[model samples]
Target: MNLRIFGWSYAVTAASLVVALLYGGWEALILCAVLGILEVSLSFDNAVVNATVLERMSEFWQKIFLTIGILIAVFGMRLVFPLLIVGITADLNPVEAVTLALERRPEDDPTSYAYLLNEAYPQIAAFGGMFLLMLFLDWVFTEREHTWLSWVERPLARIGQLNRISVVIAIVALVLLATFLADEPTVVLIAGSLGLITYLAVNGLGDFFEQAGQKQLEAFEEEDAAGPRNGSGPSQLAKATGKAGFFLFLYLEVLDAAFSFDGVIGAFAITTDPIIIALGLGLIGAMFVRSLTVFLVRKGTLADYVYLEHGAHWAIGALAAILLVGIGYHVNEVVTGLVGVAFILSALASSILRNRRLAAQGVETRKTADELAADHTSV
Candidate 1:
C-alpha cells in the first residue's frame, strides 16, 4: 500500500498529535496515538464495507463522502454523538453535558461523561448490536452465486427466499437478547427495536429510490436509443441522479453511524477523556478509515478479493453477537478487534486460493485445446 494514498490520514495524525500535546503534554499525546491505532485496528471491516457502498457512488458524491462524510464521522458521530447520549441518558442540557465531559475524569469523577456513557452501554449495545445483526443477516440471506462460506451461506441464502426473513431473524435475535442477555430488558427491547426500525427505514428508502432511478434510466434509454448518457465521467455518481444520489448518500451515512457505534463506545475503554477519544478515534482514526475506503475503491481491491466482503459481514455478525453478550458482561476490546481481523485475513486467504485454482484450471484447459488442435493438424 502506497503511503501517498493515505496523505490525508497522515495529516490528521500529525494534527491530532499536536492537539493532544497542547491539551495534556506527552501523556495525552501517547494516549491519543494509542486510541487512534485502536480505532483503526477495530474498524478495518468498516472500511471494507464503506468502500463497497462508496464505489457505487458517482465521483461527485464520492468527493462528498470523503469530505462531508468525514466531518460527520469524526465530529458528529465521534464527539457530539457521545454528548447526545450523555445528555439524553443523564437528563442534562448540551452545555451541562459538555461541562460534565470536560471537567470530570473517569478515574476520579464517578459522574464523568465516560461513566454516564458506560451506564448507557446497555442501550447502545442493544441498538448497535441489532443494527449490525440485521446487516449480517441481510448479507447472509441475500442470494449470491459466489460465496466465501459456501456451506453456511448457501443454507442461509436458501432460507432467505422467504419474504422478510432478514427482518424476522433480527426481531427474534433482539427479543432473545433482551429477554435473556440484557440487564434492562425493557430498555434493550426499545433500543434494539429502534435499531431494527432505523435499518429498515434506511435500507427501504435506498431500495425504493434505486428502483425509481432504474425506471428513469430505462425510460431515458428508450427515448435516446443510444443508451443512457454516460456524461463526461465513468463513475457511480454519473449513473445516479436526484433521488438515487440523495438516498445513496443517506444510506452510506446511516451505515457509517451504525458502524461507529461500537468504536465510540469502545474508546471509553482506552480513556474516559472525551477530548482524547474524539481526537484519537474520531479524527485520526476515522480519517484513516475514509482514506482506506478510497484506497480500496481506487485500487479495485474488492474486485480482486471477492470474498473480502463476505469475511467482513461474517466479522460483523461476530461483533454483533459480542455486543449483545457485552450487554451483560465486559468483553475485552482487544479480543473483539482480533476476531474481526481474523475473519478478514481468512477471507483474503480464501480469495487467493480460489484465484490460484481458477488459474490452474484455465492453464489445463488451454493445454488440452492445444493438444487437440495439434492432433487434428497432424491427421
Candidate 2:
C-alpha cells in the first residue's frame, strides 16, 4: 500500500477514534466504526460525484479542500449546524441547546425535537412542493436543450437579467412561508434565514478569495514566462482564468452540502446521538469523500466517465428537493435511498446506451475506411 494514502487515512480515522474515546469510551468507538461504514456505503455515489468537480480544481485548492473542507464538514455542519437549528427552532440558548443534544440520554425520549418539526406537515409540504417544482423546471428547461427536446433553450435562456433577482425573490418567498406558516414563526424564520445567510456569506467570501487567487496566478505566470524559455506556454490571462476555477471548487463543496441534506436528516432517524452521529456519519463519510477525490485524481476517472457528472448534478437537484421537504415534512430514509438509487440507476443506464451508440458509430466509420482502402489497393 502507498504509505502516503495510508497515512492520510489513518490520521483521519485515528483522530475520529480518539475523539470518540475521549467523549464516550468504547461504545463511542463502536458507533464511530459503524457510522463510518454507513457513511462510506451511503456516500459512494457522493464521492464519485464530488471527484468530478474536485478533479477540475487546482492543487492548492485541492489541499485546502482536504484540510479546511474537512473542518467545515465536521465543526460547521456536524457540530454547530444542528445545534444552531435546534436553538433557533426550540428557543433554547445556543450553548445549552448543544449541551442538551450532546448529553441527552438515549434511554430518555429524544423525539421531542423530531416531533416538533414533524407536526408542521403542511408547511413542510409547501416548502418541499415548491422546491421540487423548481427542480423539475430546472431539469426540464436545461436538460431538454441537451436532449434536443426543443430547438432552442426556452424561457431560462431568454430571461437573462432577472436570474439573480429571481433567486432573491425565492428567498423572500421562503422567508414569508416560514414566518407565516410555521407553528413557531420566529424559530422557523431564524432557521430559514440562517441557511440563506450562510449561503450568501460563504458564496461572497469564496468569490473574493477566488478573485485574489486569480491575481496571484497572473503574477506567477508572468514570472514563469520572464524566467524560463518555453514553447507554447499558456499566457498569464489563461492562468488568471484559473481563479474562476477556484470558485468552481467552492461550488462543488456547496453542492456536496446540498446533496448531504437528506442523508444528514436521515441519519437522525437512525440515531440522534450527536457524538455518535458525528463519528458514525461525518468523519467516516468524509474519509470516503477524501479517498474518492484521490482516486479520481489518480485515475482520471472524470475524463473517462463522461456522463457521471450529469448523473451527480441530477442527484444534487433531487437531494435539494428532499431537504426542502425535511424542513416541514418528514422524509423517510427508505424513500431517500430509493429516490437516489433510482436516479443513479437511470443515469447509469443512459451512460451505457450512449457508450454503445458511440461504439457502433466508430465501428461503422472503421468499416467504411477499410472498404475505401481495399478499393484503392485494387485500383
For this target, which candidate reaches the highest lDDT against the unseen true structure? 1
Against the true structure, what is every candidate's RMSD?
Answer: 7.8, 9.5
Segments of candidate 1 deviating more than 4 angstroms: 107-109, 226-240, 363-379
lDDT of 2 by residue, 1-379 (tens): 4556546666778888889888789877877777676565556567665564465457777777777887787666656666665676677887777667766545234445443333433333343334433433333333221231123334543552344543555466566766654666665555555555545544455556556655766666787878963443455444554654566566556645554555555665656677778776777667666776677557654444444444554554565555554555566766666666666666656666766787888732112323322221200
Evaluate model 1: give its lDDT.
0.81
**Candidate 2: RMSD over Cα atoms?**
9.5
Kindly report the root-mean-square deviation of model 1 from the true structure over all alpha carbons.
Answer: 7.8
> Model-by-model lDDT, in order?
0.81, 0.56
Model 1: per-residue Cα lDDT over 1-379, one tens digit each: 6788898789889999999999999999999999998888888999998887776566777888888988988899999999999999999999999998888575445688888888898998888888888888887887764677898889988998899898887888888878887878999999989988888887777667666666666766675686556554334433546555566778778777877777888888778888999999998899999888988888877777778878888988998888888888888888888999999999999888887887888732112323322221200
Error of 1 at 278 (Å): 1.2
In order of appearance, the predictions have TM-scores of 0.90, 0.65
